[model samples]
Target chain A: MAQVTLRKLVKMYDEVQAVRGIDLDIADKEFIVLVGPSGCGKSTTLRMIAGLEEINSGDIAIGGHIVNDVPPKDRDIAMVFQNYALYPHMNVYENMSFGLKLKRTPKDVIDGRVKQAAQILDITELLDRKPKQLSGGQRQRVAMGRAIVRDPKVFLFDEPLSNLDAKLRVQMRTEIKKVHQKVRTTTVYVTHDQVEAMTLADRVVVMNAGLIEQVGTPNELYHTPATKFVAGFIGSPAMNFLKCSLEQAAGALRVRVSDTLSFPVPADRTQRYTPHVGKANLLLGLRPEHITETRRHTEPNQHDFDMKIDVVEPMGMETLVYFSVGGVELCGRVNPNAGAAEATSMKLLADLNNMHLIDDATGKVL
Target chain B: MTDTAIRAGAAGPKYGSMSRDRRWALRWSYFFLVLFAIFFLTPPIYMFITSLKTSAEISAEINPWWVFNPTLGNYIELLTQDTFLRFFRNSAIVSILVVTITMAISVVAAFALARMKFWGSATLATGVFLTYLIPETLLFIPLFKMFAWVNETLGIQLMNNWWTMIILYPTLTVPFCTWIMIGYFASIPKELDEAALIDGATWTQTLTKIFIPVALPGIIAATIFAFTVSWAQFLYPLAFTTSTSELVLPVGIVTTLIKGDVFNWGQIMAGALLGAAPPLIIYAFLMDYYIAGLTAGATKG
Candidate 1:
């Protein structure tokens, strides 16, 4: 088990900075996932940790030992690539045992480790088959098996499941989490899929445009994102941001989204939002789950308003309803039985307790 | 029921017309195939038929295509002659050595050019292909003069030896073999070597255990090309080696089997047929791999 540490890591491709100066600390056996959209430098950071890519300026320490000039083989890290780079010529057994054989480990020990890894991956029957003979999911398992047999200090995955189909990707995501739990090795997985990051990572590091936006637990990222980007990026159906202006009311504060629609700020946030009243370039951020169909009984900080549904998508358990507020389109998830329809006004409730007020100028949550 | 019947009737004639057109097209294709096959096969067929005829039968004003008194006399004569056997041995040794040397040098050079990037590597790769374009016919004169200079300066006899062809053939074969191997090596994904690198494999191990096996088809194709070029090469062996024992198959057959204005047609045809045997057998067995190697650059192997 090892903890990984990065200090002011920076990488530049000519003039474009792929990874700017950033620092992070990962605990022992912690599965940390670096997640972002394309070209966000998540993969670059993982490659640096694997010693596949040289860092322009930084110190990467694995198990508290700095490995700046070490080559990838000496770094004691195993990587599973996006395309499942299994030795196409070697069968599953040889692919798994290749690293140990290179290090001149005893043949019996190599065989034992390979067999154990195959058993853990549930691919014992497939040991004799080549990579081409296996399915996409099986190949991915072999790629993971190759890493596990090495028993390295760290495991680096660069979007290993991206090549599989959607259903297989989800299955492999769970499979990866299970394997990580069984092995408990320090893992650094990189992906553009937030759902994969949220499901597999012990702690998710959300990156945006070459910098770390936030690093927190999955639930922490979901419930309390640190920045506007994180708040917008963490949730599916994405948190909607509506341009609004804070206003002073009789004894409370109100966020006026349009000339006709406004939400009263919760009593708990009134003191914090008092200074932002009449502020320009302010946005009210609310997740799709936070806005739902109205109920017979209302809770504190829950306010109701009417919206004309532009589209209604029924997703078995939940119905995603889309509507517009002052020219900004917003999505809300409601119960499938809520009777939502096209071009019809429906009463919806917005929970102010889960709402985030963001500064549009700075892209930060207040 | 009437509409369904009409629909079925409409589709039936279209399917029939398509099959009829395909049948006629197939017949036309076979006809041209036979025509082309006869055109290409006539020379070798004549050579085989003439090799069976005695010299008297060949001189007689009879059917040239028909072997009146067919015998294996020419084959028996050439096989018994020590000089012809020496020619065969020289040709075999030269071709085998050239293939081995060409593959060894090309595989290493291609791997370095394809995978390991450094200063001027791209230009060097292009330069290698450019060397292949310089035909040996134009360079043989300079090479001939260069060998003389080597003999005069270093006091080493670099001419009139069967092994000297081994040295000259790679200049013709290495550039092309290296080009083919570079294409094969580049087609492999970059992540494969990176995976091997992380597996604690040295660069040499990766080349031997990973690349050589993966690019075996291309290597085979290159080996065949090098062997064929060295085996059938007439000009270089003629200019470099003039003695009867030092001559390889192609040049030895013409120089020894045909005296001044007098040709031993039966023995010459038999020797030519025997010389063609090795390449023909090789191609018959490895035809698929040769085609795959040739097309690998256009599509994934």
Candidate 2:
């Protein structure tokens, strides 16, 4: 296993820049995930690191060796593509052994490696079956087997689970995590699924529009997103943003949303937003889980407010309640037994400890 | 009771007319198909019938369709003749050699044009297809003049040799085969080649180990086309090679079977039938692959 470092990586396709000046240091034996929406340059970054794409201007060093001029075969990296990319003409054993044979490994070693990989992927019975005969999940296992048998220094996955059905994607997601744990190879997995990134990566690199937005541990990203974009992109159901302005009211910093609904900023975070006082377009970011119906866990910074519920969806474990706050739609998580009903008034608590105050103009967490 | 009556009345004509329309459509399709089959099968049937008849029976002023003396005489005679065997041998050699040359050149050219992006490769690919569009009738004259110039300057007589067909046939086959192969090669997913490259295979190794095996159906289709063209080519072989020994099957059968004013119909029919057998056998065996290769690019793109 080796650390892959990318310094000032830039990729330009004619006039369009696909990857722009990305610098990341992926440590040895660390599972790093690059997650973003489509066309965010995450896959392009992975491909550049794999040497499958030419770098316009960058330095990519794998195991402390610069591979800028190296061909893909000499990159000492293996990739699992989204489509599984198995040779349709070859059986499972042949497909797995192809790379080793190209390396001119001994027959016994090739057989042992292929069989071990197949055993790891649970595809031992499919050794003699061609790709066309296998189901999609089986083919995926075979593709992984092909990559594992190479035992490359780095493993690159470009949306490898996107083609599977939902349940199988989840199953294979855990399988990949298990495989990485066992193999402990330096891996960079690219996917648009934030949940996959959170579950799999030792570090999650959130990218947007050809630039890295944020890089941190999953817990750091979840609890303290560095930007408005990262906060919105990382969570499922997404964090809600309410456009409000900060003003000094009676010697305490209070955000004025409307005539009646305004809450004081937390005492510790008040200093961060003090410079932006009288700013009319500050955004208040809140996750769904942070807005609760119960008041027993409230701190000194927490505040309670009343709002009319527009719709309520029971999710078995918890309930999701949607309501309007100062003409902006916001979702709050509540207890299923809280008796939420449409168009009815309900009391909700906002935990200010986890709230994010963002600058509207810059979209940055203040 | 009134509602039930209304529902039945609303549905009655629609269901009946739908069945009637489908039946008529099926009948028309089969009728046209049989008509087309008869039109296509008549010439081969006639050739087989004529091949089974003696010269006496052919010119006996009898019923033209029926053979009074059904004979294997023509078949036995053609099979025994040294000249006929020589023509068959020459044609076989030319067709096989042409196939090998065409496949080799086309596979590499197609891979380079389709997968390997260089300067002006798109234009070059279009130029190749455009070359295929240029008729052999138009190309043969200039090719003949060039051969003559080479002979005058380089002291090489390429005009009357059987192996010259091996050299010249690719001019006809390569452009077309290359175009077909370009389509086939382009139809394969780009990821497969990337996977092969990452698997430690070089470009040549990828072509041989991954591409050639994956695109085997296309290669077989191209080989069949090349063989058929070389075997059945008439104008070039006739213009270039005058000797009976050097002539390929198509020209040999036509020239040797007919003397100045006499057409040897029985032997000519027998030779033509025999000349067609190789391609026929190949198509019979590989028809599915041929169709797949032909249509792979259109459907994929």
**Candidate that scores best on lDDT:** 1
Task: Tell me the spans in candidate 1 whose CA falls farther than 4 Å from its real position.
Answer: B1-10, B287-301
Instruction: Please give the interface root mean square deviation for model 1, in Å.
Output: 5.2
What C-alpha RMSD separates each model from the true structure? 2.5, 2.9
| Interface Cα RMSD in Å, per prediction | 5.2, 5.2
Candidate 2: misplaced stretches above 4 Å? A294-297, B1-20, B288-301
Model 2: per-residue Cα lDDT over A20-133, one tens digit each: 999999999999999999999999999998888899998999999999999998989999999888887788899999999999999999999999998888999999987877
Question: Best-fitting candidate, measured by DockQ?
Answer: 1
Tens-place lDDT per residue, model 1, A1-366, is: 589999999999989999999899999999999999999999999999988889999899999899988999999999999988788778889989999999999999999999999999999999998777788889889999999999999999999988888998889988999999899999999999999999999999999999999999999999888799999888789999999999997979998899999989999999998988888999999999999999999999899999999999999999999999988999999999999999999999999899899999988888
Give per-residue lDDT, candidate 1, residue A25.
99
- Please give the CA lDDT of all the candidate structures: 0.92, 0.90
Task: Score residue A229 of candidate 1 by CA lDDT.
Answer: 94
Q: What's the lDDT of the predicted structure labeled candidate 2?
A: 0.90
Error of 1 at A5 (Å): 1.0
Report the lDDT of model 1 for residue A67.
Answer: 95
Q: Itemize residue pairs with steric clashes in candidate 2.
A: none
